[model samples]
Target: MSIVVSLAVAVAVLLLMPATATLRTRSPSVLPAFVSLPSAPQLRNRLMHRLLRRQARDSRRRRSLRLVDAMVCELRAGLAPRAALLAATSTLTEPLCPRAAAAAALGGDVASALRADAASLGLPLLIGVGVCWQVSESTGAGLASGLDQLLVTARADEEVRAEVAGQLAAPRATARLLAVLPLFGLMLGSSLGVSPLGWLLGSPGGWAVLAAGVGEIAVGLWWISRMVARIERDLMGHVKGAQPR
Candidate 1:
């Protein structure tokens, strides 16, 4: 009897799990990630992946700063936030940057649109869109002033990114040069019939040189990350400014 009772209780708990999840789903605070719409159940996860890819692509092609400035300027033109976003994006000469405008016109959720758009990558734009949508939906706040603030943040973020890119310009070039420098030296030594293994394993002096090179490599990476983060702080500032509603 005791064993049967325990099994019954275990089954009962298992059954309640789904119910509990349903209840928790209704509460955004309890959810770990952003809430998903019924229209796209897997949207949040997909958006996150898209956002990561956008960040990666952004590093290679940095052309959106002017686009952000232009968008912000339009936002400050006393237009509705959604309309401004749509109109500004429609002016994009690129294939990807303008998608956000179409998404805006469709009244899609702001967060998802910004994250998934390949031609655009910034935490602030997403936030601004979200806040603007929520405010417009709930109450007619001073949208023009809100947009001015958003534009300022967007510009500041771009400036920070530009500064960091500038800072990394020299160091990144040096890193590439250093990476190939040793290979050339090794090739010269080999051509001259010098024993490469003697330097690789037999010599304490060579080992020390290798260690220093490794350390410098690490430091170079750290420098780039710190520079990017300083810019990211401005990016996140804009993002937070637009949080849910």
Candidate 2:
């Protein structure tokens, strides 16, 4: 009888408790539904990755350009093609230079070595340098003149790329501004004593609204970025393909 009375009391206590109390107890086991929370860290990581990749690409491009310029100078200084190549390799910091010098010394197709290194370095412009060397070899043309023309074309292309990037900057800035405007609005509301941050963090409805806002912002930024990238890629592809043979 005592056990039965105790069981009845326990059941009454459970029934008297609020539904939200039970939910709160089980909430720890459930995955969080708020997707927009703490997104800054992820965004920061992505930005850092993009910055590092761009830096690496710019460094490679500069190195490749310098290598070509050096080879041109050496050729003009009356070095034989092999000697010029070796001198240029001496100026480079990468193992690619030594490998290319070795290939030239071995009497192999040094143009092929140049092409391989260009591909590995992600410098599409260097492919033209290899083609110039190959054409000089096949036609008995002046290698120095061919490389000088290549250097001029490369400089022109770099200038054009800079112009295009400048033209695109406005759109990129606008997209970033749009993405950040909602935060400014929230700040303004907080200044007016609306306590939006508190409400969003403290209430379930506000959480849902915050999640939707964040999802929209992410999607809009992604779409804008994708469109810009597609346009830039297409323009670059056209420019690369239009280079003089």
Candidate 3:
């Protein structure tokens, strides 16, 4: 019974805690006509989904940076723009890479293909590459030079993100610690044979107290996550010199 109670409490605490999103590069989606705080389970699922998406986006951004660096190297080696793009993109595993590479090989509108893929895949870095490709083609500018400049800007943006993430780490940890403190309290009570869980789950007044405490903790964690996200977005805009859209 004690183990079961402990597991239940842990799961409840975990479900209530929202994951901190370090960056949001995209614009906010259009709101629904009606807005309301979702139920606890629904909110938990959405938080998990957002966390996963953020991880994937970060990974993709790193890959995109690598692609740019590789392209620069290839271009400096005297490869043509189309060939360099294809070669660099081939190193990536994303679906966008292959489609853009194919467009380059087929002499299609590679920039348009890149833009379309960027929009679909939520990879905004690709949009900059597309613009570089278009400008290089229209003005006879060196694509390599353009990409080199972009690489510098992208690296700066990356550094700002890293700094913001490091700064927010303590707050995120503190929030998690606070969220789990109640579990420790329960454990202490159980060790003392106080049967805290029994009281909380068994009695009407204890149930009310449990519900209220959980709700408040959940709201507190959510608020912290929101504040951190806003800080990340703002720092990225002001410090990195690129506003996320």
lDDT string, candidate 3, 200-235, tens digits: 655556655666776788899889889888987887
Model 3 weakest lDDT span, ten residues long? 22-31
Local distance difference test, each candidate = 0.54, 0.74, 0.77
TM-score of each: 0.45, 0.75, 0.77
**Model 1, stretches more than 4 Å misplaced?**
1-82, 95-123, 190-245
Which candidate should be chosen as best, given lDDT against the real structure? 3
Global lDDT for candidate 2?
0.74
**Candidate 2 TM-score over all chains jointly:** 0.75
Ranked by TM-score from best down, the candidates are: 3, 2, 1
Better of 2 and 3 by lDDT: 3
Position 42, candidate 2: lDDT: 54
As for TM-score, the candidate ahead, 1 or 2, is 2
lDDT of 2 by residue, 62-174 (tens): 77778888998999899999888888878887754554678788888888887787777778766887788899999999998988888887787787678668878998999
The residue pairs found clashing in candidate 1 are none
Question: In model 1, which range of ten residues has the least summed lDDT?
Answer: 32-41
**Which of candidates 1 and 3 reaches a greater lDDT?**
3
